[model samples]
Each structure stands twice: as structure tokens, then as C-alpha cells.
Target: MVARQFIVRHDDDDHHIEHDTDDGFEVLQSQIFSLTLVPPDQQKILANVNDAAINADSDLAAVSDRLVLVSVQDQREISISDEELARLLQAEEEAVYLQQFQASGNRREFENRVRTYVPQVFLYEDPMRQEAARKTVPVDEIEEKSLIFLAKETSGHQTMKKAMPSYWSYSLGSKNLSGGTSGMGMGVPLPSEIQYGGSRVELYWCNKCSKETRFPRYNDPIKLLETRRGRCGEWANCFTLYCRTFGYSSRLILDFTDHVWTECYSHLLGRWMHLDPCEGEYDKPLLYEKGWNKKLNYVIAISKEGVYDVTKRYTRNWHKVIRRRNITTEADISAVLSDITSECRRSFSREITSTLKIRDERETEELETNVHIPVGDSLSLPGRQSGSKEWRMARAELGSSDQNNSEQRHKDEYVDSHVTRIHAAFSHLTSRISKEGVKAIKKLLEDLRASPFRERTAVLESQGIPHLGDLLEAISLKGSVRPDGRVSVGLAGDPVLTSLALPVALDVVEKIINKGGNSD
Candidate 1:
């Protein structure tokens, strides 16, 4: 006897396991186990072997050993070999490294970096994919039953009758029941099988669509429904509003010259489809510019997402379009577009992924590049001039605002009317106040400080700054300084008015000072 040490192990059940065995004894034990393993069980053991064969040779054995260990643990009692345990850990580490490599090579990050080379001015906001996903909800799909009813009601209108497609009448008259909701309780009349020409004439209805007939006093959809006669703009606005009521992503596209139309997101097409309600046309994007032979310089599309200058879509020739778009220079238009796109990205649905955003930006860049032409020393054709002091100041205010308020201006007729009234008053006051001298404007400011908040905003809103620089200089010269760094001017009796007016006054002064300093 040689001095030899033997080791023993026990599981939770207190079953002993032998260790420190020679190759000869272990082989004999394996032979005995193999003899007991039936053909059915051998298939289970070989399944892991087949799985390992598909992997690379370096990790193949390690993976197979791990699978064998797992199968053994599940099927029968067995002690794990130390070599197999080490191989299993090696395989896991290799797997983790491979995953990290794959994650680090994300295509999205690469695409984003590529997009950085393109100018921000060239980027645009697009929400087609997001709008498509939103269409999955029942509420998002427009009740065609409502459209059918509206078409029938407006079909007799001479202008609308010409515009209405024959299929619309057939679709409504015939029992083609696809894509229509249950109109039973919705107050919508059922489709009539009896086909009839649109020959009905009501006393209030116009024999021919006139300019006066189109401008409805009320532009709401409900009101439009009651009154079947409206202008192209009104019809478009009402149609867009109705589409929105049914949960469709809709926008009112305005051609700065005069025309208006609706753009509704089409889930079937996976993009926005132009719908001219007045004309009863769908997806006819070029109908205005091409069909009507209209010269369009600017086509603005306003939606809840944001405002967009979609002139490129309407104008194929950039050089010709830029000549007509002389009201705003290229630089100014670029600034406005950038402001609008940024605002949309901030406020649009969160589901809009970065990949889609980048794709939209690339498309915009292509459009911009195609249309861009250098004017150099040559000026564009003379259009509407906005060089007056008040117009210039308003332009400055619009540019200075954090977000472009152009969309806000076109949100509704109510807001537009208020703005128009305010603008007119502002123009009058600016001219009179400047002629009367800065002293007269300073007196008006002193009166405003003591007024209430409502009165202060009313005056500011009504009488915009006549000469921002002169007004601010007069205030700083006439008003007393407070401890809090605000000028103590305006109505001393009303604290809210004084508080509101002082900040606004100071902000105007700072902007004027900055503007002058920048020029110098």
C-alpha cells in the first residue's frame, strides 16, 4: 500500500458520489450506464449532440457539454465534471461579447450620423407611419356613412354636382356595404337603391355657386352641414374638421393666393391623400396648380402637429416659383421652415421613431436641393412689400417668438379675425404715436401701468408697439426704477397690470437694444 487519498460527495438526499477515480474505472461505470439507457432515451441524449454540430468548432464542444449536463440534471442524478463547468462559463462569456458587438453596431445610429451632414433647414416633419398606426382604432376610421349623407345633401348644388364623382352616387345608392359602419342609431339615412339625378332645388340653395355663396358666416362642420352651400375654402375647412371629428389625422392646406383644401391621412395608402370636398376629388394633388393652371408661390399646410411650407409639392420649377415668392426672401423662408419643423418634432406623437424622422428629413433635403437656385446679385420679382416699420416689427416679433405663431394665426376664423383687428389697430397707433412724438406714447404707457391685467393685455394687444426702440427709450427715460429691477411706470393703482406691463415693456427694450447693437 501506497498512501492514496479518496474523496466522496453527497447530494441533498445524502446520496454519495464517488470521485478521484482512474480512467479505467470511470469508463467501466459509463459502459454500465450506457447499457441501462434505452433507445428512446438515447435519442434525447443525441438531440444535444445534433444541436452542437451546427455551431463553430471552437465553442461547439463547450455548448454540447453544457447541453449534456442540463439533460443529465433533468433526466437522472449525475455529478457535474469540473471541465464541463469551465467550458460552460467560457461559452457564456463568448455569447455576451457577441451580443455587445451586435448592439454596438446599430443601423439607426449610423443613419442619424449620416443625416447630420444635411442642413437642418432642408429637414421636414412627416407623420405617415404614426398616422397609420393610429388608424387601427375604430374611432380613427371616418364613418363613410356620414360622407355618403353629406354627398347626397350637397349633390344638388350645381358646382358640387359637377365635382362629385358618379361612383359616389352609385356607392351611396347601391348596397355596397364594405368599409361602412352601422348607421342605425347615428341619425344617418340609409342608402336608397332608387337612382335619381341631382335635380332638387331648395329656396335657400343657390342655382349657381357664387363668391358670396361660399363665405359662410359660421365655418363649423355642424353649421356647414345645415347650410349645404359654401365656398371652396369653407368646404375644405368643414371637411377637414369633420374628418377630425371621426378621429382621422386631417389638415387644411391653404394656397396663400386664395384656394384651400383638405388632406386626410389614408391608412389604406399609408400617406396623406388630398381631398377637395368642394370638388369631390380625392388624391388629386396637382389639380390646383396643373389642372387649374394656377401660379402658386406658397402653399401652407396647418395641422395640430405644426405649420409647414409645402410650396415645393405644388411648384415643380423652383426658379419660377421663387420669382413669385418675393414677399419673403429665401433666408426668411428657411428660418420659418426650421422653426416650424422643430416645433412639430417636439409636439408630435411619441410613437414617431427616429428612423422615420430621418427619412422625412432626407426627402425634404432632396426637394429643397432640386428647387434651390442662387440669386446672387439679381433680386426676385417684386411681390407684396412689407418694409413699413410696423410690418418689419411684426416680422421681428414672429421670428423672435420661441415657436412660429403662423399656425396659431390660421387655427380658426375667430383667432384670425382678432389678429386682423389687432393688426389694423397696431398699424394706426404706430403711425400716430410716431408722428405725435415718443412723449405721447410714454404718456399712454404711464396710463397702462395702473390698469388691470385685462386692460394691460388689451392695450398691448390692441395697440402694438408703434416704434419698439423709441417706446422703450421713452419708458426708461420717464419711468421710475423699482428695487426689483423693473421700471415703475403705467397705472400705480393696479399691481397685476403694472406687473404684466413692466415685464413686457422691459422685454421690448431688451430686444430693441439687441437689434440696434447687432446692426452697429
Candidate 2:
């Protein structure tokens, strides 16, 4: 059986109504008839229907007023469930939301919001359950049904409709082909693999310079070629439009620092390559190799995964310095390069550490001044005084010889243990803050600090330190060694020196050890 569906909207009430007919239907505005037919007579009837309709209705309005009459010999049927229809509607809604989010530059926020709501919205909607109830048909059966419907609708006559090919077909071979029967011309040259093409245009705009920019040739032709100078964003957009006009897939990537570039998918290369047209001349390559060094390796490092890989490359380069130094194995340059790199990374991390340190200092000052105490158990004046005494006792409990050790030892040890970790964490944290802002980092830090293990574990993990449990076990097993070369039995399990005070005291010792080590 054949069916026709059309939508009518009333301007008076802005209401849309859909009308469906089983027989032949005439489109008023287009003066087109859709007809269904019986086996032997179907083709003959449809072939003459268009001419008959045109003769019967002198105008488009008269053609639209004509009633559609359809004849059916078979009773085969197909049905769609309400649940399936709902799911289809939901998918469409989600697609629209995603499109709007991307267009508004809120793609990330939209993803976050959707993630936050997905569970609540889809808690009862199970794909497996829906599929279990869904009807299934063989591929041939579906194809046969579709063909039958087409034959019935056309009344054996070919339908007159505009032909539009798929995007892939257009990109591959849509040009140079003859009308309707021909395909897009294949072998259209792809966009040039030049980096900073868009960026160059942007830079030119900033510098108030004007120049012609070239893009990869694709079948689709660009409209509105820009002549005046524009920024990197403008240039990148223009380049993207040109590529799109040629049926080439292109993207514009803008960085937090206002760095803009263009990327296009190269079908021949089977990879998306970077193009920075703004950085160098239009004809220059994207990345250039100078001996073993790769220059202008511009990539969008947007996530921890991306940054981690990039860092690994830098770390590997540092390792190469060891072999290239041409010194004894004992004088490996790996440590030197690592130290320099670590220092640079630490410099960046310091900003985060400094901010956190300021917060910590403020909290400490508030605690000292007894400024509002956090909500929890209340401490009486006597209890507070006793707590202070306990803190003093904890410090005084340390051995005289331990306190008398070289002051530099404490600084060196603390610095060694904490500085590298602090630097790395600080760097990661700063990067997060730079991309997502301070509020995100602050919330993350707050969550981490609330956890029993604290975010310090992240620092330890990065430094390849043993797990906290193992460290605690080690501290428990080897707590204190006396000057007499004997293990202090009670001290091993002492809460004061072994567990409570040791980690804090070690921080000081670490600073001293590092200071002395650096001096040597």
C-alpha cells in the first residue's frame, strides 16, 4: 500500500497539522500527484496520471483541491510502536541540543550538563529492553517492502524529484559529471598541507597587512573571498569556508591564548593534518625537521591525556642528553637536563602552589586567631588549652640529637622530597586552572583535601613514590634508630614520633637534605 503525508501550518494560530492519504494525492502548490496502483494496471495508470491531473486542474490551486484515489490488491502491513517513536523523538532532541551547544561555544558545558542530567532522564529507558520488544525483519523483506511502496506511490511512473547525493559522494566525485546521471568529479586536488594558513591571515590583520591566502582545492567553490586583512579567527574561518565550499572537511581550532589555526581531513593521507597559514608563507610545510629536531610541532594539547604524551616526548629528549653528553656513566647528563626541565615545570607549578599556600596561610591564621571554627564538635576552653599542650609535647618529645643535627639537613631533605612533587602537581593544577579557571581547581582541591588520603597522593604517584600504605608500613617498622645502633622498641609504635610527628618532621629534614645536596 502507498501513503502520502503532508504538513499544513495555519498562520492564524501558528498550528501545524499533518494530513495523510492512502489514495493518489495532488500537491496543490507543485501540481504533483502521488498515486497507488493495482498489479497489472498500476504502471499504466501512473504513467498517465500526471498528464490527467494537469488536464483536469487548470491552476496549481485546482490541482491541490483534487482528491487522491489509490487502489490496493495486497494487504501486507507494517507498524511502529509508541516506544520506538518516543526514542526516535528523544534522539532528535539530543541531536538538536548538541548542535545548539556547539554553535554557542558551550560544547564543553553542554556535555557537562548533559552528563549531569542523563542518569535522571534515562533512568527507566533501557535500550536492551526496548530492543527486546522491537520487531525485526530480514534485509530482503525490508527491501522488497520498500520497492513495493515505491511502485505503488509512483503508479509505475518514475517520480520527479531533485537529486541530492550524500556528502561523501559529493566530496569524492560530484563535479564534472553530466546531469543527474553523472557524479562529482573525482581527483579534485585536496587542500594544501600548509600550517598557519588561517593564522597568517590573522597575524596580517593584526599587523594591518593584506594578502591573498590559498587553500586546498576541493570540488566545492568558496563564496565571498575576503580581501581586507582579518585576525587569526577570521582567517581560519575564511579558510574553513573555502575548504567546505570544495566539499573538504575542515575545522577551526582556537586556543585559550587566542592562538588560532586550521585543520583539514586529507582523504589521501587518511589523517587530519594541521595547517598554520598565518605562521609562515602560504607554501611552507606545516612541520619542518632540522636534523633530529622537529620544529613547529603545533598541536592542540587540550587534555591530560594529550599533555601527558607531549611531556613524555620532552622527557625522552632529556634522556638523550645523557648519551650525547660524552661523559662517564657516573657523570650522566640526564640528571642535569631533568633538573632543568623540572625547574621550568616547577616555575609554572609555583603559581598554583602559591595560590594554595596563600589559602593555607589564611586558614592557619584564622585558626590561630580563633576566628570562626568549622561546624563540627565544639571544643571547650580547657580542651583547647590541653590540645595546645599536646602539640608542644609532641614537638618536645623528639630526641635532643635529632634537633641538634645540621639545620641544612632538614632543609635539604624536605626540599628533595616535596619540591619535585610540588612542582609537577602545581604545573598540572595551573594548566587546569588556565583552561577551566580557578573555581574548578578550587572545587577539585577541596574534594581532594576532604578525602582521607588527600591530593598529596597525586604528587607521590607522579614522583613514583611508594603507595601511602606502604610508606606508613615502612614508617611503622623502622620508626627510630638510636645513636647506639639499637632499635627503640617503644618508639617504633609511638604515635607521637612514629606516626603523628614524623611526616611533618620529615618535611623539614627533606628541605635540609636537598639544600646540602644542591650545594655539593
* Regions more than 4 Å wrong, model 1: 1-216, 267-270, 340-356, 362-520
Model 2 deviation from the true structure expressed as Cα RMSD, one decimal place: 36.6
Model 2, position 223, has a per-residue lDDT of: 17
Tens-digit lDDT track of model 2 for 449-520: 333321121112111122323333433322233465432222234322232223333443344334442221
Question: What is the C-alpha lDDT profile of model 1 across 1-520, one tens digit per residue?
Answer: 1221221111211112222223332322233233332111122322144543221123222222222211121233224466755564465455444544434334343233223312211111124323432333233112222332233342212222233322212111113334332222212222221111112211222223311111123333343344444456446755565556446766678776667787765432233556676656555555554444457777766665545566676554444555565444444455655565565568556566464465356436534542332222222121111223354355332132213223443463234332344344333334434323333343455455444433342123223333544444332322444455444433334333234234344343333434442221
lDDT of each: 0.40, 0.29
lDDT of 2 at 417: 36
Candidate 2 TM-score over all chains jointly:
0.17
Q: Which candidate is the best by lDDT?
A: 1
TM-scores for every predicted model: 0.31, 0.17
Tell me the deviation in Å of residue 402 in model 2. 57
Instruction: Estimate the overall C-alpha local distance difference test score of candidate 1.
Output: 0.40
